[model samples]
Target: MKYTVLSLFPEIIDAYFASSIMAKAVSRGIVEYRPVNIRDFALDKHKTCDDAPYGGGAGMLMLPEPLGRALESAGARQRFVESAGAGSAGRSSGRVIYLSPGGRPFTQDVAVELSREAELILLCGRYEGIDQRIIDTYVDDEISVGDYVLSSGEVAALALIDATYRLVDRVITAESLEEESFSGGLLEYPQYTRPEIYDTLRVPELLLSGHHENIRRWRLRKRVEKTLALRPDLIRRGEEIGLFDGETRKLIQELGGEG
Candidate 1:
């Protein structure tokens, strides 16, 4: 899929696009990135994109004009479809997401939802934030990566891209996505490789045992145990959503947990 990052700091986002899976994806044309500098669309000689906030604020607010015009001229929808090898999705009405502190909390489900879209434009807010006019005019959704604030949205945008891109068809193995954390409504069980023994701790015996059935049972138990101990909320929510089977229900009861 095509990812258009509207940022004042395009360099920060560009640096990451050149390496690892993203780099390879770009080369293969499986995914593409276009980082538009908000300032590039500025009309004045200074090419300014921010100004002191009206009504009094500590930091400057990004202007609406440059960002809006940049998104319009850059053909946000066209680039995103071509990047994903999906061809041009006419008029790219997919999603225009704004990254901000007050946005809806992001989740694995959200990532999965976004991966299905043909195109996405992420607005990276800076300083205090972007002008409200920009958000009202173009934003499809507002999403926050986490509770705490970061210095810039560039990092958040990269993270969102990595999570969403890997879910695209052929970007990574389907089985790999299936095994990742949160894939099954529970965290993944521990994985081990190479040296059988690390320091004094050995790999779990069940993982090494040749009995596939027994190993599967062991992994399921561990996944339930770990989720119960660390993220009981997930289990509760999972059960509410009809994700738990009789076997899993019995397991939870055996562990002195409800639902």
Candidate 2:
């Protein structure tokens, strides 16, 4: 996968791509991170890119001109190109996704969808927000990480990248990916490592037994338990989607249908 991030603060997201799993992915040619500074496209010597809102607002609105140049220069007309085919998350159309608080809630499903794209152009709006014309003319979708607001779109863009990039080919192993939190429509079970006994507490005997079936069952039950306790909403969603199996149903019943 290839990522093109348009941000006034390119440095904010650039350092992240240069380290950790992302860096390794880049080294292996699994993905590429291209951050385009919007300021560079500013026509003025002072590089002004924002101005006061027309009807009056608390903050400035990003200008349409520099943004137009940046988006156009980033292959806005190509719409994914013959080589890429950057499908719309998973649909037929290619897209430029803008990160904003008003957008649809982003989820694991969205991450899974975006993993298939050949290229992704992420727009990180600053000041109040980008001009609506730019969005109407060039953007394909808007995504929000949550209901809360942030200082700008750059932080949210990093979050979206972090979630989706791991799903890209070879960025992580299938088994590892499958075991992560939210993979099974529930939070992951607790994890353990060395120091079988820590702070006078010993690792679970079942984990030490090396019984794969028992361990798997234990993990599943723990997943259910944790979801019930911390995020019953996920359990409700799982039920609505029929994600739970007979065993999970039995487990919930065993717990008296309570968290």
Candidate 3:
């Protein structure tokens, strides 16, 4: 899959892409990414991308011309102009998403949905926000990482990328992805490593047992227990989705969770 990010601050994107699993994935060609600077598409000598709102507002609003051109360069549309010898897809496009506080709540499901796309163009808005015309013209969806606001959308874009990329084939082991929090509507069971004893507390005995069956059951029970303890809402939703089987349901009941 290819990910194209349109941001005024490409440096932020660069730092993240330069390290860890993202770096390895890019090197192996398992995933491709390109960061396009919104400023690069600015039209004038001042290289300005934002201006005061027409009706007036608290902060400057990003200009439609620069942002529209940036999205065009990022593949929001198929049309092209010859100045830079580029097309609407300066990179490519499967979906165009704008990161904003007023967008759909982003979740693991959304990450899974995006990971299936052949390409994704992420727009990171700044200042007051992008011109509405840009969103109406090119955006397929708008997504938010959380209820709170952040200084820049690049941070949110990186978060969306992190959640989606790890699910891509060859990015990580399939088992590693499946056994994680939110994988099956439940938080993952706690994990422990060497140094069995820490702060006078020992790792769970079941995890140490060589018996695989008992350990598996223990993990499942603990998964339900933890979800119920920390997020009963998830337990309720999981039950509605039939995410738990008969044994798991029984386990939830044992933990005082409604089936």
Local accuracy by lDDT, each model: 0.83, 0.86, 0.88
Candidate 3 C-alpha lDDT tens digits along 1-259: 8989999999999999899999999999988988899998899988899899888769988899988888777767733444675555433446989999999999999999999999989999997888887777678899999999988999999999999999999999998977699878889998999889999999998788889999988888888889999999988998998887889889888889898
The local distance difference test score of model 3 is 0.88
lDDT tens readout by residue for model 2, 89-182: 2232335899999899999999999889888889998878989988766778899999998987999999999999999878898889876778
- Candidate 1: segments with Cα more than 4 A from true spot: 76-91
Error in Å for residue 258 of model 2: 7.2
Error of 1 at 113 (Å): 0.2
In terms of lDDT, the poorest run of 10 residues in model 2 is: 85-94
**TM-score of the candidate numbered 2?**
0.92
For every model shown, what is its TM-score relative to the native structure?
0.91, 0.92, 0.93
Give candidate 2 regions above 4 Å deviation: 78-94
**In terms of TM-score, how similar is model 1 to the real structure?**
0.91
Which candidate order results from sorting by TM-score in descending order? 3, 2, 1
Clashes of 2: 0
Which candidate comes out best when scored by TM-score?
Answer: 3
Question: Where is model 3 more than 4 Å wrong at Cα?
Answer: 78-92
Each candidate's root-mean-square deviation in Å? 5.9, 4.8, 4.3
On TM-score, the stronger of 1 and 2 is: 2
